[model samples]
Target: MDFETSDKVKLLQEQIERFMVKYVYPAEAVAKQEIEASGDPHHEPKVMLDIRAKTRELGLWNLFLPDPEHGAGLTNLEYSPLCEIMGRSPLGARAFNCNAPDTGNMEIMAEFGTPEQKEKWLQPLLDGEIRSCFSMTEPEVSGADPTGLQTRAVRDGDEWVINGHKWFTSGAIGARFAIVMVVTDPDAAPHQRASQIIVPTDTPGFNLIRAISVMGSTHGGGHCEIRYDDCRVPVENLLGPEHGGFMIAQARLGPGRIHHCMRAIGMAERAFEIMCRYANTRVAFGGPIGEKQFVQEWIATSRMEIDQARLLTLYTAWKMDIYGKQVARQEISMIKVVVPNMLMNVLDRAIQCLGSLGISDDTPVAAMWREGRSLRIADGPDEVHKMVIARRELKRFA
Candidate 1:
């Protein structure tokens, strides 16, 4: 893969970086205050609206999708750097209408949704007029093993009735609809048992328990806990083919991991910068902490690790474009384990370098630390991914 960034993506990278500095950075605290004042942690702060408008005006919107009609028409390799810039701030993705769960949902809908389904749910989402969620992980099942999913969706005349318990339904609290993975055929093959159904949040018996707090903060459309107690949507609400939910879910993860890993790298890059600055300026004894051997080592190691993870991430994206996502599964799993752990390693060094200030929210490091911890578990846990990587490698030798 060419190391040189194309003129087009280079321009996008520069614009997104500028957007991050001029808008997302300033809006972080403003958004927090607005949400606090509104008494709704998930409230869409007004500053976000301004950010969105500005991104749209600059023609920097829906960048995650490769669809020329709806998105920036960039391949995974082309989009990687742009995604990294957007990953620097928590608000960056949303500013460009390319946030998670929503991005994944949009991808599947664009590929699978029928014309009527696209007209009703997909367009509004593409336009940023509505948000959506994925309801797949369950409180009762081991999320890492999705084939064991217990949620049931029964055909009831013209409607499908859903019933199950779900937690960590990311972005469910304020979403317009959810793409729910449910068992429509218990007797079918493990991978073919579940189907994805679209359930509007307002549908009867769609019970939203609450947004589960993460590290004592429930901001944005929080990771929600919800239940479908006979919740019903029209039969036409099914997404993709029947018994194809498992395949669709796997399809989304490969590209989504590229976004997640690159974004984590962006956070690590910011934290590394913050740590180096503090090391150089914060004095102890007779000199800057950066002059100390331990601090020097921390900075050196962080730089090496960040660059290594980034190259691996970019390589994975390139492979996904050159080969198909399925062909690049090993690299995908490898990065899924490598990048998040690299992020945590960098964050830990930065935090230790900052001492008390790092543990506190004074710098973005601690928040990034808290948030980055989940990356090891989200998508697929480090253990599961490592196992997959190892198994794939072992099969070649055997």
Candidate 2:
């Protein structure tokens, strides 16, 4: 897999590292103060705008997309390391306009949108002038099995009427629009029944129920609960082919899953650094905590696990580049199940090492821990990925 960083990626990686240190890490405190002062969890802080401007100026904008005209034109393998660097800070990805839901949404538009759709939505998103969300999960069904989705979209004259409920629509609070998945052909093949449509946030009958909190915290442009009560949009808003939502979704998630893993490796790396720093300097029982055998073991184990996970992620990315997403499904599923669990373990140990300080907001550890916990179920649960892996493996011997 050539496991080596190319000259191009190395230069980009160096720029990203410096930017995180000089801008993003420092802005964390400012962002928190702004969010607190506004009393809005979904508030877009001024500091974020400043950071976004700086990132665009530095030519770091749209690094996640592969389209040369819209993005940096880097392949999955080339983008992996840069993504990991962004993972270190919570605000890192957004600063460069490489954040989730947006990245995936942009990919869909670039790959499937009509010229008009691209002009209306994709351009502003690429310019960082707007944000977006993906609404697929529901309150009554397991999101892992999307074929069971209950949302309905019925054709009515020149517009389509959509009616359904969705939650965990991440980044919906202030988004300009949403890429919604709804059932267009209930009696068709299960996988072929759903279709994706774009609905503007301002459309009538489209209700923002609330910004649903995760682990008691509602992040900016929160994971939301939304209802489309006969919300209507022009037929031109339909994304991709009719009854092709499942295929489009899988394509969107393939790269999205790898990006999540890449960022997770960075998160784990940050936690390990925090744990080691705390253990080596903090005095306990007349000596540093590093003197304790268990603490030393934790440090060693964290280093080993982080390295292993990173390599696996890189290999999966390389495979995707060489063989395409379909051929790399097994590898993708492997990392999907592996990386988040590794992050959770590393975060737990870091929290333990920091003692009481870790659980508090004094450090990023607690928030990171919460994020890692949610990731286990976010893209797809661990069990579902595991099932994919097992079924693939079983096919070999059969």
Q: Write the residue-wise lDDT of candidate 2 on 1-398 in tens digits.
A: 79778999989999999999999999999999999999987889999999999999989989988889788999999999999999999999999999998999999999999999999999999999999999999999989988899999999999999999999999998899999999999999999999999999999998999988788998788889999998999999999999999999999999899999999999999989999999989999999999999899899999999999999999998899889999999999999999999999999999999999999998899999999998999989999999989999999999
Q: Least accurate stretch of 10 residues (summed lDDT) in model 2?
A: 212-221
Residues 1-398 of candidate 1 have per-residue lDDT tens digits of 89899999988888888878888998988988898899977889999998898888888989899888767789999988888888888888899998998999998898899999999999999999999999999988899999999999999999999999988989987799999999999999899999999999999999999899998988778899998998988999999998999999988888888899989989999999999999999999999999999999999999999999999999999999898899999999999999999999999999999999999877888889878999999998999999998899999999
RMSD of 1: 0.9
- Model 1 residue 315 CA deviation (Å) reads 0.5
What do the candidate models score in CA lDDT, each in turn? 0.91, 0.94
Q: How does candidate 1 fare on TM-score?
A: 0.99
- Candidate 1 Cα errors over 4 Å, as ranges: none
Estimate TM-scores for all models. Answer: 0.99, 0.99
